[model samples]
Target: MSQAWLRQPERGSVGLLRFAAWLAHHAGRNATRLLLYPITVYYILTSPAGRGASRDYLARVLAEPPGWRQIFRHFFCFAQTILDRVLLLAGRTDGFELAVFDRDGLLERARRGQGCLLLGAHLGSFDMLRLLAVEQAGLKLKILMRPDHNQMITSLLAALNPAVAATLQPIAGPADMLRLRELLAAGYVVGLLADRATPEDRLVTVDFLGGQAALPATPIQLASRLGVPVFTCVGLYLGGRRYEAHFDLLAEQIVIPRSAAMDATRLWVERYAAQLARYLKLAPYNWFNFYLFWQA
Candidate 1:
């Protein structure tokens, strides 16, 4: 919930993304994947903030302090996810191994048209989860997103699939809130990224990666108001062509009485932070918040 990510400039341009998309489609994935090496190297060399963030995160997650090789791999893993996002969005999931670990039956509920709040962190390939929940499991999923955060990437991804773009409910004004309520009422799962807190958001600090980091309280707060089921989800990239989507129920219904609202919110946020940390260690390179994450 440090706003450092908001302060950082968008790294790649639309034209560059378009070219990458073009290459991905025309040349096969194996051929196009070769480009990620240079792209990863370019970012590692050019973006000092991103490099430092990688080092800091890896140092906490790994047994030993991270070196150039670990940093390069971290950036490369992120680049790989970005590349796969293009393919996944374009409906080109031919060779990739897509696995889902939904032991809690949340996905089955989604498949049955039961509405819930899917709260996730920026830990892995969200596009993969979207593919599994929407395309595969047939869940009516509406993602709450700020399109203006990374306009170029958003625009490019939208261009790939207009249908997916239509599912994006922009996080603006009261009208969007009304839209979310309507969707939930009609049995649609609302997807939200809960880790990053904007300036307007209320936050709760928790122990994360051996340090105290603030996370947004608003997602859980909104769930409490809406009185819906809430689940924590993530799609982990397990190297090579394998990706796994996990879904775990966080709450049957989030209820915070006014008298204990702060404590209630903190409890839920801490639970989410603990789950996120567990997932972070499972695939450390997949933590893609490319900024000083432990700072304000």
Candidate 2:
């Protein structure tokens, strides 16, 4: 993949994140949460891009443009999730209440020594599920992330706990692709976020949140190539300290015969998009793609 992803700047500063981390650890989670009201207001007042994105997304799903309060709540929720990442990564999960709904027994019945791909989105904290796999089951889960997609937040999160950040993998050229294949063969679950497209990635547009939107087709390619089931995982914040995670089996298998490969991939991408849209409806504020997602 091209390094265009590196050029896409993130919203926050590393210095501010580091300061938040210091406050969370030294002053405690509750003590530092007093900062979110101001932080949310700052973003609402200063960041038009993110605020517009939030309102645009909300309007599509809510069937009307969102009020300032609803938009403010969106930013505040995102802020809370980021703050909780510090605690979750630092092994302070006792303060959180997690409910995992694996209706298809995806997480519960995961093969102990086999590898599969976990398809997640930018909706909620994908890091939340990492704690479950890393601390509870000890599964060999490696996340596939762009090299510099979230440079500021990534660096500060890594500073808080280096172990979790160590699992991020890149799937750019042939060499990295070979490594990912080898990891799967070696019984490692490779997790990838399939919600957005990188510049080098081919876009697959489908109906999402009552509008047509483009999402990356990489996960379909990987699941078919590796001959593994793709499981859909969502971590939703219900408010305060409660978060619900659902790990449902999305595709049993994806077989793209050479004669009809393009058609097959589009069909599969549409299926994934429909499922993602349903999850978005369930948790409106949890949609965290703070950008013009439906736009180019």
Q: In lDDT terms, which candidate is top? A: 1
- lDDT at position 217, candidate 2: 77
Q: Summarize candidate 1's per-residue lDDT along 82-172 as a digit string, tens digits.
A: 7888888898988899788873477667666678999988888888988855457667778998867866776787889888887788886
- What's model 2's lDDT at 116? 74
- What TM-score, computed on C-alpha atoms, does each candidate reach? 0.94, 0.91
Candidate 1, overall lDDT? 0.84
Off by over 4 Å in 2: 1-8, 13-16, 107-109
Candidate 2 lDDT by residue in tens digits, 1-296: 12223343564534446667788889888988998789778878987777887898899877567999899888888888888877888888886988878733554445555667888887777878778633466677788877656666667767878888888786657688889888888878778888878876777777677777777777788789988777888788889898888876777778988898778888888888777778778888988777777743
Error of 1 at 238 (Å): 0.7
- CA RMSD per model (angstroms): 1.8, 2.7
